[model samples]
Target chain A: MGDLTPEVQRIAGNLLSQGQVDLVLGWAKAPSNGQSVPACIRQAEQAGRLIFDQYCIHNLATGLLDHRDSSERIGIFVKGCDSRGIVRLAEDGQFPRERLYIVGICCPGMKDQAACDRAASGLFGETAGDSELAGKCRQCAHPNPVIYDELLGDQQPPFLNDVRFSDVQRIEAMGIGERGEFFSQIFSKCIRCYACRNICVACNCRQCIFDETRPQWVGRSTSAADNMMYHAFRAMHVAGRCVECGECERVCPAGLPLMLLNRKLIKDIDQLFGPYEAGLSLEEGARPPLSSYRVEDPDPFVR
Target chain B: MKSFAKSAITVVLDRLAEQTRTYVPMRDGVTSNFSPWSERRASDLALNSLNTTFSPKGIVFPQTERLYDFAVDGQRADISGTHAETGENILFGARACDRKAFAALDQVFLRRGYVDTNYKARRDGLTVIGRDCLQPGPFCFCDSMGVDPMGADGADVLLHETTEEFGWEPLTEKGQALTLRLNDLLTEKELIRPESAGCRLEVNVAGLPEKLRGMFDSPVWDELSTFCMNCGVCTYICPVCHCFDIQVMNNGSSGCRFRCWDSCMYPEYNLMAGGHNPREGKRDRFRNRFLHKLEFFQERYGSFGCSGCGRCLVTCPHSLNMVLVINRLGEVKVDAS
Candidate 1:
């Protein structure tokens, strides 16, 4: 905290003063309380309000969508996760990558609010400190942005965690009947609210296929089959493109183990196609394995 | 590229398991899918096996993922989203069909607007190790798409299964790095060329776009529509189909929004907010699926979207294979020839 506050101020002030950007999008302490929220500051004087800390978990990339068509270039402060979203948006050509200046910050794994609450209730007293972080932060693999124009903090090393497919392995160990029951139970809880789809950065579409009523592809009733269709179909759409950001699972109010569904797909994609990433670099001209036709592809189902 | 005795393939797999999670095709009950490799699991890791009941797209896209989470109190809202950790893993035994599917998905998700950051992160950290397919299955028509059964374009590390020995070739930097780590398990030897097999089906889709355009109003769709249940099993199982929808939800005072998968087979797929449905009928919807695959995706990305994985044939309740549909559609040859 020695020069953090001052450093943020300096960067924000300099960017504004030098006309590097018309607006600096960063986190500022809420005027009413200690909470930090996303702010779009235009003047150098507002730099004093900018803050950077654990509470600054909001993905600033969402704000960029609002400014996509704006003439004024924006300077955004991004955490590792937010930077990925920005990179994805840029890769998709949603906006010009050169238009914005990125201020990246390295992150250590953040806390999980719900997981901490359960752990505290069992062992420690009511006071558990600030053991709560965002759910996505808890399992974050890339706590540092891969691409950034101006990094504010010292670069952190890449995460080297062991591959843990324990949840999927456990499900695989269960009998077929048991596995069916498990998925049935989990899918049965789906209300078709589509909270997962909304939060997904990859899910930015002007008109979604689910909302298309002319085709009547899927029914409006939130029945068990319809919900399953919705979840499974949504997953397939983003298949080979989902980055496993964990935003969909965290937003689920019902606390569904949504990560398991994604993990299962990720595992399968790795097994089927060669290693491919969504937006790291745009070097290869080849399409994703699932979307392209190849004459010699293996298809044992064909007689 | 070095050829090792059939017995040595297991040795390489065992060594891979010591450091990374290794997956191989295995039968879980009646359905076949990729499962983790174990030393005593030789029977489970069936090489050159039948197509799994499910498409392999699950490796990257995932069924459920958190885009970001936001909560609003009064007028203020807080949001949080995170990216996956980066690490190397070996995709032990991928089939060529699924490998081709990755290319199609990449075009739709990665090539189109906003490279999916989440897919990029997970994909970059992965190394695809492919195995050759010796025999074509019932629905196999990858040959019609001009894909090589023993190709290594999509694979970082390719393992060619020969009659007497298995050959391993590293095609990318990631594969080379993985090979360096697995030096203890492998012996350095020259790469052995693989024998190529003839494909089951041969198709000239060069004129497919023009053919489809003329046939849009053809009665062939009536024939195709008779068997279609409109269940979307074909679109759901196809490795390259990428249509989706965005939705917003409110739970009391606070709510979140999402974009989920959407299919063209359903009648409600084209309905707007004011009850306006564009592709209202099954015939139009069916036509859209074909047109998008054979025309639109190709028109946009310079390639047809179908990877010829044939999962659609197995999953479809009526057993509708695109090859047959395309062939039947092509039967009424526009006489332009």
Candidate 2:
């Protein structure tokens, strides 16, 4: 992908200098030339640091929640998936909509950091279908921001794939015992590092269930049992709220196929609740599928 | 000195496993980790992997370890401390960076004024086999961190790999004993090791810890923390981060106390029992994590806590690792100086 540094920096500098926003949230070149990390440009002078490239894999919207209570307006740069995350948070009323100045990017796709490293190519070595882009990006439906104030580049055409949930289906096709083994093995790799939970924008609870001491829902231990419960509970919690950003799976150090569980819920949410997609718009998401349901909604467990 | 053919290392490991448990870098789905030798373990031994996703420290200091078990009967209460295992652990194929990390860990758990007996026993019982990392990973900066990828200071035995053979050099009594046990498999050969190709990334750590003393109020931490996803990957992957949380796991009037790896990046790590949390913001937690690795640990251990394994560089969601912190802080320091 071509570097959009000049335009991104110029726009961010304009916003910062014009006093239009208290902070301009973006990505900057990390010490590793191939990688770009999230950057928060509070001053106009620092806007030169902002850059947009394939290495900007982190969903910057999750970082924006830290500034939710602040009254000052903040300028945030968001890709398609990241824009959906912003809408997820906005639906929960964590960050006020008026305070957010969204600078949306027409994302092609962000490449996987590990794959990029293995490619051994210094920069812009995103080989197509070599598993370079994150699985979410690979199965990406929307490359254009769903919600934004101002657009950066021309809108990207819809990039949805016919086999978006093919991988999820493979898991669904497995027997109950086989699925249990698959997930059991996935949780075995978990170190209880909380990378999956921390990177997720859907996990916005002030006090997490994992941290509770008296009840101790999820032990701090990395035991397979603990890991399994932690993931199962988290999957249900983000059921209707998740925007399929895939940031949770992308951020996991253990390489857990978290989206499989999520995609299953998403499919069920669509199948039973009659076609629901969370975070499509900025407004408080249409009551959600599980939270507000019709009597006619299918109950697979019952029948 | 003894040598074994590269292809025959598994046969050697199988023989070694008969005496004691042998650990090698094994593939787990996508990532590689130093796990106990098993039928499921890849025979290739993941030597091609630059660095394992988790450090070898887990072999010595497991993520979750029971200190003691407590039992409450109908009338009486019983408490029992865990006994140290008899059979020793032979950790083979550790990279020089990991060996250096063990040296750093030695200062924390062995030579410190208050030595932890549990860590000491585990340290004493285990034998480390260091491997020369001929080709450093894309993100490896062990050279910049003053670590030679070919050096084996902490390892009991050193092994250098080539296309044909693995040159084994024993450095300690434990390694000598193991060598003698494997004498049938090993043959006397000239010690020829490969020269490291060096690291792709270079981080200047000269006078870094001292320079970091005055950087308490620096704005760089804010910038770095903005991108930091606040995950424990860096700390867990780090070879020498020894911070742990002690907890009691109770089951129906019976309980067991164990300690698990704790990351400063976590909100709960520094949080007190009271309602107030001092390091509530990600910036403060992130700053503390780096400061501990760069400044605090250096002050206490007289060496930086990082080994430049680059596991964190690859694993971190935002690519936020020690190299990034060191380079960025170094840049700021140079600008100020």
Pick the lDDT winner. Answer: 2
The candidate 1 chain A region of ten consecutive residues with least summed lDDT is A118-127
B81-159 per-residue lDDT for model 1 (tens digits): 5534355566777778778888887877777788877677767766798878776554566767757776776899888
Whole-model lDDT values for every prediction: 0.66, 0.80
Error of 1 at A247 (Å): 38
lDDT per residue (tens digit) for residues A1-303 in model 2: 456788889989999899999998898876456467777778999988788877677788888778877788999999988999988888877887789889889898877665555334221112224455566687777778989998877777665565767888888899999989988988888888888888889999878888777678878878888888998999999998888888887766666778988988988788778577778776545567787767887766885
TM-score per prediction, in order, is 0.52, 0.93
In CAPRI terms, where does candidate 2 land? acceptable
Ten contiguous residues with the weakest lDDT in model 2 chain B: B38-47
For candidate 1, report its TM-score: 0.52
TM-score of chain A of each: 0.82, 0.90
Writing each residue's lDDT as its tens digit, candidate 2 over B196-302 gives 88887888888988888889889888877777767788888788888999988889899888888999888778788776779988899999988988899889878
> How does model 1 do on interface RMSD, in angstroms?
22.9
